[model samples]
Target: MNNVINWFEIYTSDFDRAKKFYTDVFKLELTDLPVSSDRHSQMKYATFPVGVNGIAGALVKMDEVKPGAGGTLVYFDSAEINDELSRVEAAGGRILRPKLNIGDFGFIALVEDSEGNLIGLHSMA
Candidate 1:
């Protein structure tokens, strides 16, 4: 097995609002993905920029899927977790937990995004 997780999706009810929230929080500029004919009319999605070695994921708006604070949690790579934590509230998010040492791993913090999605931030600093 090369990787346990190949891709991830953050489902949202409001595509534009969620897109804005993510872009503002992580400074991510997402791009629209072309949906197949079979799914085009039913859903819409935008993907985060993929680095040369980074994983791929997307923000999806579909009738069956709903975004919230439960289920899978996605931890984003952070160069400065504290700095990001400071911006959470201003970005329309709430800090669920402050940055704390994770033994030999580094530091981690939890936050709830504007769309009510619980997300994690990890950093080595």
Candidate 2:
């Protein structure tokens, strides 16, 4: 009822590659998140840095979770959509859509990350 979404997980087949892509684009290092139980040894993940009150999220890799386009699209907040879009390709991501004005809402751009996930970048400019 509050924020509606509390946490999110971006599934990936390659942990290191995905980590690099995210870190490069966002310019933030992701901390390792351990899978304590043996039952989940096949599963691996790392968490993105978040403020105390900010939403929690992680990059997860597991056999059951297939990373690809479609399904739920996660939008990342950006101060400059065009600047971020410029970094997408060099970071191992392909731009699906160039930065476009959204009128009152500002701007947005879509891209596919290294692991084939369609992620959106939103900005006020």
Candidate 3:
């Protein structure tokens, strides 16, 4: 298995605000995707750029889907957790936990996104 997870979706209530929050925090672009499926015709989606060997995911907005915090935590790979942590609040997020060493697993931090979604940041630094 190349990866345990292939795709993921981060639900949002405010599409444009959420998009800007993510883009500002990560310093990367989220490419808007054209809806291709009838089942999801009403949902707006913008995907985080998938690296050559990384998983693909999108931020989604729809009436039925709601974003919440403290559920399943999704960890974003960080070059240095501090770099991203520094921008969390300014980008419309809250740092729930400061960076800490995780023994041999490196370091990790927890944060809440603009959409009230609990997300984790990880790095080996």
Candidate 4:
């Protein structure tokens, strides 16, 4: 197997809101697909194009799912975190923590999207 992460997903309760939030903040177009009969009695799921490549992940809703306090970390190819933070808020996301440094790795901040899913953004300046 190649040492690469092909895709990742964040289950959300509100598909439309999640799609809008990520699209606005990340500026990536999301394609939504109808769930199969085997999944949640036919709920909708969202697929997001990760970065510039063709890789993607499904954002689906599960009845047993709960809001994650902290888990997913997405790194944007940015030199500064403030700009992304601004975008996050403008895109209907709430900032959980301001930008902070983590040794020499870079800066990271936690935010909650419109669907109430918590995600982290990192920039290795």
Candidate 5:
């Protein structure tokens, strides 16, 4: 089988807060999975679709795991990095770094979502 990232999970303290952050910023739909007796409150997760036919991930809550300022770097494709950067603030996210030209590689910007997750945005010139 070809090697590919099937999915990723972001561990957070509050599922509802994280869900709102992601949904507002990325325009993603988050659906909470019903709690089961076997799992109890041990497992809480929500899935996020990155793109059409693309890899997806989930938001999980683990009491043992503490949220960090930096953990993962998720890149999203954008046609207009500048415009997206503007939307970041309105979406309750902060721009860690403004869009910068990367020579032939295109443009990239670093941003922190409302939940404090650092993510990157990329656009091909």
Candidate 6:
């Protein structure tokens, strides 16, 4: 397989707040994604920049989706983990663990998003 993952969704309770947090932390604006069907009237989401290192993802909010920690953790690839970690707190996220070397694989850091989701940051540098 060229890539195992195609897209990902990060669930949030507060769409606006979560959008702002992600935009601020990543330094990129999220384009709103609309739901056309009434069955998903309560759903709202915004996608991250496409083709970002070939990973596509979105911040979603819906009734059935609950945002929290200790679930499936998604790791965001970074050129430098510190660059993103440095802005975590100011963007409303808490750094659970600072960047740590992972030998040949590279470095990784754990953090909690504004919505309380645990996210990992990875970098080769």
Best by lDDT: 3
Output the TM-score of candidate 1. 0.51
lDDT by residue (tens digit), candidate 5, 8-107? 5577877789889999998868877543323213656676765575655667674434466544446677777887898998999999767755444466
- Screening candidate 4 with a backbone cut-off below 3 angstroms (N, C-alpha, C), the clashing residue pairs are none
lDDT of all predictions, in order shown?
A: 0.72, 0.70, 0.73, 0.60, 0.66, 0.72
Local accuracy of candidate 2 as per-residue lDDT tens digits, 1-125: 23434445688888899999999999998988665333423767687877586666678675544688553446787778888788889999999767755444456566899998777776667
Per-residue CA lDDT of model 1 for 1-125, tens digit only, reads 23433445688888999899999999979988655423323667688887566566678775544678553457787777899899999999999767755443456567899998777786768
Cα lDDT for residue 85, model 4?
87
Model 1 / residue 80 / CA error / Å: 38
With candidate 6 superimposed using the best TM-score fit, by how many Å does residue 76's alpha carbon deviate from the native? 16
**lDDT: worst 10-residue window of model 3:** 34-43
lDDT of 6 by residue, 1-125 (tens): 24444446688878899999999898998988665334423667687887856766678675544787643347777779899988999999999767766444466567889998777776769
Give the winner by lDDT: 1 or 4: 1
Q: Where in model 1 is the C-alpha error above 4 Å? A: 37-41, 71-125
Poorly placed runs, candidate 5 (over 4 Å): 35-41, 69-125
Clashes of each: 0, 0, 0, 0, 0, 0
Clashing pairs in 3: none
lDDT of 4 by residue, 1-125 (tens): 22133344576767678778888998888776544333323445576764566344656564534436543334344557788788987899998766755443355556788888766565655
TM-score of each: 0.51, 0.51, 0.50, 0.45, 0.46, 0.51
Model 1: lowest-lDDT 10 consecutive positions: 34-43
Best-fitting candidate, measured by TM-score? Answer: 6
Preferred candidate (TM-score higher): 4 or 6: 6
Alpha-carbon lDDT of model 6: 0.72
Extract clashing residue pairs from model 6.
Answer: none
Instruction: Kindly give the stretch of ten consecutive residues in candidate 6 with the minimal lDDT sum.
Output: 34-43
CA error at residue 109 for candidate 5, angstroms: 33
